[model samples]
Target: MSPDRGDRRAVTAGFGALLSRYRTKTWLGGAVVAGLTVSAAMALRLALSPVAHFYYLPVMPAIMTTALLGRRSSVGLAIVLAIIGCELVVRRDSIADTLANAALFIVVAWAVAEACFRLRAALDAAQTMARDMARRELLLDSILTSTPIITLDCDGRTRRVTQGAAALLGVAPNGALNQPFETLLPGFGAAALQAAQRSDGASRTLWRASRRPNGDAALLTVAAHQLPDDADPEHTVLTLTDQSQAEAARRRERELNDRLSSVWRLNSMGEMAATLAHELNQPLSAAAVYLHTGQADLARIGPVAQPTLRTLDLAKAQLLRAGDIIRRMREMISNGSRAFTEERAAQMIRDLEPVVALIGQDTGVVIRIQTDDEDDHVLADRIQLQQALTNLIRNAVDAVIDRDDGQVTVTGRALGAEGYEISVRDNGPGIAEAQMDHIFHPMISTKTGGMGLGLSVTRSIVESHGSALAVSRPQGGGACFTFRLSRPTESEIP
Candidate 1:
């Protein structure tokens, strides 16, 4: 092939390659626009041929086309316009002028195309930024609407709540806006509100609020944060979290602990039963020997004096009573089947006083027993009732043992026509507030070396008999534990 033909083919290939770089649709649209622009420029030139020059008019269309379509299409449009201008306006004799005119048009078109490209790039960047901003806004809205926590924006100066504060106050969002924050949530304390307003920088203030709505009490944790410097300085962000469920869970945990402690107490009681049996056996054996010896002497003496016979009978009766007491104690240790009977409240107290006195002797705690009604009668398992009373008395003694005026009082009072209430009160340091809710729980003890099961087990025993055991701080100083036993009616007493 000839070198001139080869160079022409290579140039054509390059031009075709450039055109193919653009989409097919763009190329077609550019072609149509270029043709119309050239036709308009030529017509304008022809009409003004006798008058003046309109050289730069065609460049405007090329620049605009470049911005709308692309650089490649604008180049094609510029080339076509340059050709049309050369033919219609330039003189045939002045070849240099014609060439210079064509070159000027091409250069102007290139400059305009470059400007269009830059302007197009700037616009595309702006569009991308707008889309990103829109996506971020959507994400923020989703979080605000779906989160469980209540969010609010408040004005620092007026303490007025704004966005996201309505859900906590149980009001419409629009209605809550511009309202005083305290009015919306009256549970919040004035001190906390004042502190939140003064908070600055990135620090946060935290406080708690309590409310009772519809007879249900709820606890909320409030957190306040300061907004950025560029934002309104008087604006603060507040968030509230409901803690009612957490408090309930804590109560359940305490109850479970109490049950566990009761189990531990049972285990300990089982271990102590053998020791108790051995201690009681010695007294019973001695009493039996005395009775047998007395009988033999009386028979050998051929009928003793009436006073001596009476003394022997009394001794026999007392021994039998001691044996009964021992058997009852064994039954309590075993925690066997209950046997309920009509029993006088005063007699029950008297029976327990010896044991209580022994317990208080070492600690110098005086135990006083008082009965409001000697006729107060209840149907109860005698041994089990005694054990429950024993536990309470022991706890009361321990509470007051350290005081110089240590005293524990056990009182039995008849309630109107229904039951009898027994209370054990002490003059000692009262229960702590932190331990109040969990005192009956197993393994929760305020005393050193305490297994924390006494109250829990006592409560279990009392509740098994259709009653509840309660503890309270007395008006004067110490703790009081009380329980009630239902009494039989007059018709059922006999």
Candidate 2:
């Protein structure tokens, strides 16, 4: 059952108990008040006056008691009043007048009691309903306090969590105070925590963690959600839902992303194949000429011609190199590309050479590749980053391809004490002044037949890997697209 429903039941039960207690008190109090007031009036009439004067005592107390006390008590009070009136009549020869007065008191008391009974019953019912409502309110409060959720502020401080949080987090009751949310939900890592804290409105994310509660052995799913802002600003609200179903949803999402990423990579390769084929042709042509010349020389002379042998060896080596380049290009287009991990940054760069080659082939634009750092890695999804870099290089090539002296340079180096910076600089018409702001935005392509998602996808990949990408005009001319990947510390590397 939902916590809310459970609380409602508790409230109803509590209200019923309260109503019963109140009704009992009301009934008893009414009876006592009626009895005391009547007895006092009778005593005063009998003790302080002449014998015949007993009939002069007021009948108001009897009537009032019947009115206030309701049917049963009111009726009983009337009987007592009647007996007193009868005694007075018996003591004197005024029996007719006394009996007449006693009968009048009895009739009045019965009527008042009947009216009081109906009114009192209605009041009692109302009181019970009021009690029930109050009980429900209390139950709602309890449910809110006991729910299994939490909210946090930007300062890494706890703002709210359900009363059941202690059980959810395995902390002592009320011990969650001032605790950093990430301490409990390790999956919220620094970036995710920051995103949640700085979010202006509602956002949802599913997280998976193998961390168990302090005193329990079971793994918990911590569903982290961010509340969005409407017109007014408010503190970010983060709720950690249960781990079971949310984790399953997250797993499915990741799998779907993986499949789509694969399709995208293949599509890119297909698009660049024309250029790659051209790039491969140049090297193959050079090796073929050397082979043909060496064969002619060998036929003119014997099997071993000194100069021809050297030339043949050089041609053989070039062919092998050309074959290696072709293989790399083929691998880049291969359907099965999931063997790489984001944990190896250097390997990621190495794996991107073929895509770069393909771009060179497609555009006939000269690309100078240079790298000064090695044995480095970063936490990044390798395939995604590869796609991003390919897109950027493709853009740079496109930017420079139309120029007579078009040139693109791909460079990677360490940014000293911070991260690794990779840049693709081109020497063609730079981004237009009006289009700079939208350069990395999706569907904002500068080229006549370009899809604008390349740069946008590049930025997404860089950011997802906990990095940043930017655009600027290179010092000499054209545009430069630069992205930084934080250098992995020793522990993060091998």
Candidate 3:
């Protein structure tokens, strides 16, 4: 059971085999025993009777036990045999000699037992050490095989990547064992080796690498640990994790936010259309009347009449204005499924014209556009910027639709080197101070039937374009929503 006991047994067996092969005479003790046996046999033959010297045979059992059995059990058996031998060989007629032989046997047996105890202790210690080694091996094997992270063992030039390491690294298997690590992982391997060398005495170290393997766009996060007593400082254990999935998830979240925002703007457009239909219908009816008058006058004159021509020109201008409003309305209602993207500043404002016109036509609230300082071109997605601006104008309209003084002012200007600012100011009830921060968050709206995604989406788009959107009360008790865009460069300023 014990390592020392087992080792001793193996050695003894091997020695016995070698001794048997030699075919030489036995050692001094064995020779003495053999001679004794011969003399006893001859003596028995001469006396014509049996000699009771069976005690001598006990030595054979003791020798065999010492070689084959473990220390404790063997020594115990030897001591018992020695006592029995003393009893068998010492004559009962000589009491003193018998006692002396028994005392001598105790002394020899005690010495043998002490030796056996020390050998047994040594064997036990060795077995315990072997068991501990086996346990550590099992623990390491489990860690290597079951962990999701990749692990590698390297000795500077050579690296051994275990099974599952390749899968984690998103790389095809190359013969990792005994091959140069650089050959397996190329550029990363060199950096990893460099990091490993620097981290030899460090308890913890982190390194970031932004590179795509095999032309794939992904970020790799590598972690390394140096092994104890490592001959080469560059020999380390490496683990790789890809951050591509996390980045993709973030993009998806942004897209979902855009879609939800688009939905909210559409909802607001519906309300705005309902609110402005009356005002727009009245103007359209008046324009139709003016056109009819101009047409009738031209028909009667049948030739170029200055007054009739002037009337016709005015009618044509009104018609164009009416047509522009209708066109803007159509664009607002016509939803395109293209994903929202960043667009230029000039392009973003230009796209909102149609939607702004539609809101003016559909709502009695008068809309005004003003610009003080000029702005450079900006980056924004066309439709998204359009939707955000549309939402702001509509919100302004709704805020003051019932008031005789209802006015929505759209203004723009440059903000130094940072960007351009486009603001929607309305003469309406201002937003409560408590609701400022929450206004941009989804599902927090003051309007009826509002999903509250309008402001939220607006902010998202603004942020995406390296811009910002904010809300505050204007000088005239009204709500104002302002968005800023980064200042454009020489090529982009147009």
Candidate number achieving the greatest lDDT relative to the actual structure: 1
Local distance difference test, candidate 2: 0.64
What TM-score does model 1 achieve against the real structure?
A: 0.55
When sorted by TM-score, best at the front, the candidate numbers are: 1, 3, 2
lDDT of 3: 0.60
Which portions of model 3 show Cα errors greater than 4 Å? 1-78, 90-97, 107-111, 114-136, 146-156, 169-174, 178-180, 189-218, 229-234, 258-279, 303-494
Per-residue lDDT of 1-494 in model 1, one digit per residue for the tens? 45797666555444444444542356666676666656675676678767976665644664455444545664656566657665666555677877776777677777777786665555555555555666897997776665433333444233333343344445666665556666656645456755655664222432233233454544555666655655543455666666668877998899778677777776787667646766876887688788878877776666545578666766675566566656665665667545677888778878776567678787898999998765588877776687778888988888888889999999988886768899999989988878878888776778899977778868877886789888889989899998898876666454
Q: Between candidates 2 and 3, name the one with more favorable TM-score.
A: 3
lDDT of 2 by residue, 1-494 (tens): 35797677566555545544544235666566556666766666657567455453355556555564444754575567546654754475577966776677667666666776665665556657667777898997797677766666656566665766656566554567667777766556657766654554323564543334544333353444455444112244555555556566888899778658756764776667746865776768776776877677686887657677766765565475556545544554564232323355556666667657766787788887777546455555555676677778888887878887889888878666676778889998898879888777655677788766678767866776667798898779999988887766656553
Q: What overall lDDT goes with each candidate model? A: 0.68, 0.64, 0.60
Give candidate 1's whole-model lDDT: 0.68
Q: What is the lDDT of residue 31 in candidate 1?
A: 72
lDDT of 3 by residue, 310-393 (tens): 667665655655555454444444652223333456555654565577777788778887764345455545555666687788
Which portions of model 1 show Cα errors greater than 4 Å? 1-26, 36-52, 71-74, 89-93, 147-165, 185-218, 228-230, 245-266, 288-494
